[model samples]
Target: MKIKDYAILISVIMIIVMMVIPLPPLLLDILIMINLSIALTIILVAMNTREALEFSIFPTLLLLTTLFRLGLNVSTTRSILTNQTGGEVIETFGSFVVGGSAIIGILVFLILVIIQFLVITKGSERVAEVAARFTLDSMPGKQMSIDADLGAGMISDMEAKKRREKVSQEADFYGAMDGASKFVKGDAIAGIIITIINIIGGLLIGILVHGMPFGEAAQLFTLLSIGDGLVSQIPALLISTAAGIVVTRAVSEGNLGTDITKQLFAYPKLLYIVAGTLSLIAVFTPINPMLVLPVAGLVAYGGFTMQRNLNKEEKLEKEASAKSPELDSIKSPESVIDLLHVDAIEFEFGYGLIPIADKNQGGDLLDRVIMIRRQCAIELGIVVPVIRIRDNIQLQPNEYVIKIKGNRVASGEIMLNHYLAMSPGIDDDSIEGIPTIEPAFGMPALWVNEDMKEEAEMSGYAIIDPPSVVSTHLTEVIKRHAHELIGRQEVRALIENIRETSPAVVEELIPNQLAIGDVQKVLMKLLKEKVSIRNLLAILETLADFSSQTKDPDLLTEYVRQALSRQITLQYAQPNQALQVITAGASLEKKFAESVHRTEQGTYLSIDPETSQLIFQSISEQASQMQRTGIQPILLASPGTRMYMRQFIERFSPELPVLSYNELEPEIEIQSVGIVNISSGAVNMS
Candidate 1:
C-alpha cells in the first residue's frame, strides 16, 4: 500500500488506542486541536463536492470521526477524574469561552448536544434512510433508461457500463450513510453520558480522596466536565452537519457555494422589493431609521449593480449571436469531416409536419417510429439502427422522405386534419373526398375529412390516420431495405447476442467456418427475400454444419433454407392448406441450369437477353393471372435452380419469392396453379 493507505490504517489504530491509554495534557490538547481541524476539513470537503457520490467515502469517514471523538472523550474523562483537570484546551474552553461559570458552561454544552442530536443528527439520519430507499427503488428505471440509450446508439457500450456502475455506487453510498448516521446519533448520547460520569466521578474523588471542600470540588469538576463536553460536542456538531449536507446534496454542475450564490441572487428585483419593504418599516415603525435605512440602501445598491451586470451580459450575448459563429464553423476544415458521417436511417419531413412529431402539439409520430423500430426487430430479427428525425425545408409542407444511408428510399405526404380511406374492392360515389394513393402499398385511397371518416367507415372503407400512414410507410421502407442495413457490424452484434445463449454454436461457426462478412451475406440474402432470421440459433447451427462443405455464402444459404424448411413452409402456407404456386416446367429448369456460368469466384446466371425477355413475359402473365384470382404468385423450382431463378426474377420483380421444392415441408401438399415454359408463350394452369 501507499503512504496514504498506511496512514489511514495507523490513524484508525491510534483512535482505538486512545480509548484504553492515558495521555499527557499537552498531547491531549494537540489531539483536541487536530480533531477540530479534521472536522473543519470534512465539512469543507462536503460543501465542495458536486454530488453525494463525489464524497462516496464519507459514510466510512463519518464512522471513524465519531469513534475518534468518543475515544478522545474517554481519555479526557480519565484525565479529569485522575488529575482534577482535563487539558489546556478543555480548561480554556471552560474558563475563557464560558466566562468561568459552571452553569453557563453546562448550558452551552447542552445546547450543542441538542443541536447535534435533535437537529442535525436526527435529520441527517432520516434523509439518509429516505435517500437509500429511493435510490434502490429508482435503480431499475435508471438501468432501463441506460439500456434504451444504448439500444438507440445514443451512447456506446462503455459509456452505458460506466453509467450503470455510477448508479450502483449511488445506491451503496446512500445505504452506508443511512447506517453511518446512527453512529453520529449514538456518539451524541455517549458524549452526554461520559460528561455526566466525569462530573459526578470527579466530585466524589475530589472530596473523599483529595480532601477538597464540597463547593470547591463541585466548582472545579463541573467546569472541567462541561469544558470537555463542549470540546467534543462542537466537533460532533460540525461532523453531523457535514453528514446532512452530503446526504441532501443533489447532482449539480457546480459545488454548494457556487450553486447557492447563483440561485440565491438569480433575481435582483427581489432584492429591490425587500429593500423597499425595509424602508417602509423604518419609516412607519419605531425601528431606528439609522439602523434600517443604511441596510436598505446597501440592498438597493446591490440590486442596481446586479441589474447592470445582467444587462451587460445580455448585450454581449446579443453581439455574439449576431456574429454567426455557426457559419464560421462550417467554413473551418474540421467541419468537412463531420459532413462525411451519414446516418444509417433518416426521416426528414417539412416544417408543417413538425406538429406530428412534437410532443407539445400532441403528436405521437415519434413514438410510432420507436414502435416501428421494435416491430422491425421482432419481425426481421435485425437491430435497426437509430433513425435520425429532422426537418427539411426543401420538401413540400406535408411531405416526408425516408432515407437509407443518405439515399431517399421512399417519400410520402400526409394531410394533418384528414384520414385516408381505401375502398374495400368497391368504390362508393356517395363518400366524396380528395383522391390520393396510399403511400405504403400504393392502394387507391381518399383523404377524407372528419365528417366523412365515419361515413367512409360505414361504407366499408379502411380508415387510417396521418400518423399511422407515415408509420406504416416508414415501416415498409425499413423492412424493404433491411438487407442493406445489416452490415458486418450488425452481423457481429447478432453473433454476440447468440453467443450469450448458445456460445458453443457461435464459437464454432464464426471465424472458424465462415467470417462475419460471409455470415452477413447469408443473412442479407434471407432478409431480401423477406425471411425472418429470428431463429438465429437454427441458422447458426445450419451454417456450422454446411459451412465446412462449401465456403460459398449462396450454397450455405441454400442449405440453411432447406434446414429451415418447416419455418419456410409455415411462413407461406396455411395449416392444412395446399400451397398454390407457379411451377417451372422441365424445359425452363433445364434452361436455368444450362445458363449457370461457373467461375472461380462464383456461379452466376448468364441467360441471353431475348430468352430473359421471353421468361419475364411468361412469368408476368402467370403473376397477373394469380393477382386476378386473389392469390400471391410464388414460383416453385428445383433446389439447384432456386437461387438462380431468384436472381433472375429479382431484376423485373424484386418482391417476388422463388422457393425450392426442398424448402417446403413434406407434410404439405403442393398445388401447381400455373406452369411456366420457355417453348410456350403463356403459362398453362393445372
Candidate 2:
C-alpha cells in the first residue's frame, strides 16, 4: 500500500493509543509541544496558501488535529489526577499564576475559552456553512461556463477537464468544512469540561487519597488544572483561527500577512486622521502622556513617511515614462514610420463606453479578444490578427465600429449599464423594456435592467450583457471576413508549423508540385466556404496527388474537398441520418455543364445573364422553402455543374452550402429535399 493510503489510519490509531496508555512525563511533554507545533503549522499554511482548494486536505486534517489535541488533553487529565503531575509542561504553564493571584490564571483560561468557542468557532462554522451552500448552488453555473468555453473553442479539452475537476473539488471541500467546523466547536466545549473535571478530581485525589491539607490541595491542583487547560486551549484557539481564515479568505496573489500590510498601509490620508484622533486623546483624556505621546508621535511620523513615499513613487513614474523609448520616438510623430502600417482588425469605441473598454475598470475586452482569436483559429483553421481596440472621439457615446484592413465592416450600439434581453420565441412579451435589434442575427431584443433579469429569464428571454453582445457581433464579423485575413504570410506560417509534425508532406508539395502562392489560393478557397483548414497535412497530400494533373486552384480545391468528405459531411449531416439537399435535374445540369467556360485564367459560367437569373431565382425559392421547414439549405449537383453553380450563385447567396455528389461519403444516405427546375413558361434553354 502507498504511504498516503496508510498515513491517516496510522494517525488515528496513535490518537487511540494516546487516550489509553499511561504516558511518561517526558514523553507527555514532547506530545504536548508537538500538538502545539502541528496547530501552528496548520494556521501558517492556511495563511500562506493562495486559494482554499490549494489546501483541499484541510477538512480531513482538521478532524485528525482535533482528535489528537483531545487525546493529549485526556492523557494530561489522567496524569493530573493519578499522580498530581502532568509533566513539566503543565507545571511550567501553571507557574504563570502561582507567582501571584490564582484568580488571574483561571480568568485568562476562561477568556481564551470564550474567545475560541463564542467568537472564532461560531463565526467560522457559520462561514463554512454559508460557503458550502453557495458553492453547491453555483456548481451548475460554473460547470456550464466550462462546457460553454469548450464548445466555443475558447479552451482546449485538457483545460476544460481541469476546470471541471476544480469545480467539483471546490464543492466537496466546502461541504466537508461545513461538517468539520463542528469538530472544533466540540473541541472547545470539551476543553472547558475537561478542565473542570481535572480541577475537581485533582482536589479530591490530593486531599483524600494523598492526605494533603485542603488549602494546599486546592492551591497545587488548581494551578496544575489551569496549566493543563492552558496548554490544550491555546492550540485549539490557533486551530480555530486558522479555520476562520480559510473560509473567509478570497483568492489573492500574496499570503495573509502581505495582504494585511498592503491594505492597511494603502492610504496615508486615513493615517493622518488616525494620528489627529490620537493626539486629541493624548491632550483631552486622562491617559498618561508617557504611553500616548510617543505612540502618537510614531503614528504621525508614519503618516508623513507614507506621504513622502507616495510623492517619490509618482516622481519616479513620471521619470520612467519620460525615459521610455516609445515616448522619445513620439517626439516626432510625422518622422516615425509606425503610422503607415494598419491593423488587420480594430475596434473603436466611443468616449462614453470608455469605462467598459479600460482594463482597470473591470473591463475584460482584451481577454475576450484573445478568446475570440483562439475560437476563430479552432473553428475556421485560420489565425485572426490581434485586434487593436481604442476609444474614438469621432463616434457617438454608445456606438462602436469594427474595421477590417482599416475599412469599416460592421458597427453597433450598446447600453453599458443595461442587459440585452432577446425573446426566446416561446412566451408572450410580458416583460417591458426598450425594444431593440440584436446586431449579430438581426433578432428583436430589449434593453432591460438587472432587476428585470430574473423576470426576463422566466419569460423565456435570452439575457446578455454589453460585453457578450459585442463579443457575439465581433465573432460573426471575424468569421465572415476570415478569408480576407489569410494572406501568403499566414499560409507560410501554417506550412512552417505543419513542417514540425509532417515535414515530408510540406517538402513534397511546396515548390516541387506547386509554389506557396498556389497552395495559399487553395487554402483560401476552402476558408471562403467555411471549411476548417486545420487538417493541413491532408490538404497538402491531396494537392500533391492532383496538382500534377491540374495547375488550376479551383480544380485543386475540388479535389481537396473530395479528400475532406468526412469532415464536410459530418459538419452538415447528423450521424446515421440522410443528408438533406436540393439537386438540379438532368436537363438543368446539362445546360450548366454546356455553359461552363474555360480560359487560361479560370473557369466561368458563360450562360446569358437572363438565363442565370431564372435558374438562381428558382434555386433560391426552393432553398427558402426547405429552410421554412427547418431543413438546412444544401445543394448537391453533378461535379461539373457543382463548381460552376457555386461560382455562379456565390454572389447572391455566399452562405449557401454547395457540394458535388462525389464530395459525400458513400455511407451517408441522401434525402432529396427539392429539385431546381427553371420555369419553362418564363424561359427556354437554347
Best by lDDT: 1
Question: Please, what are the lDDT tens digits per residue for candidate 2 over residues 256-370?
Answer: 8989877889897787788788888888999987888788788889989988999899999998987887766767775566678988899999998887768899997877877
* TM-score quality measure for candidate 2: 0.61
Least accurate stretch of 10 residues (summed lDDT) in model 2? 677-686
* Clashing pairs in model 1, backbone N/Cα/C closer than 3 A: none
Computed on alpha carbons, the lDDT of every model, listed in order, comes to 0.91, 0.87
Q: Which ten residues in a row have the lowest lDDT in candidate 1?
A: 677-686
Model 2 residue runs over 4 Å out of place are 1-9, 48-56, 96-104, 130-176, 203-220, 251-253, 269-287, 322-527, 530-686
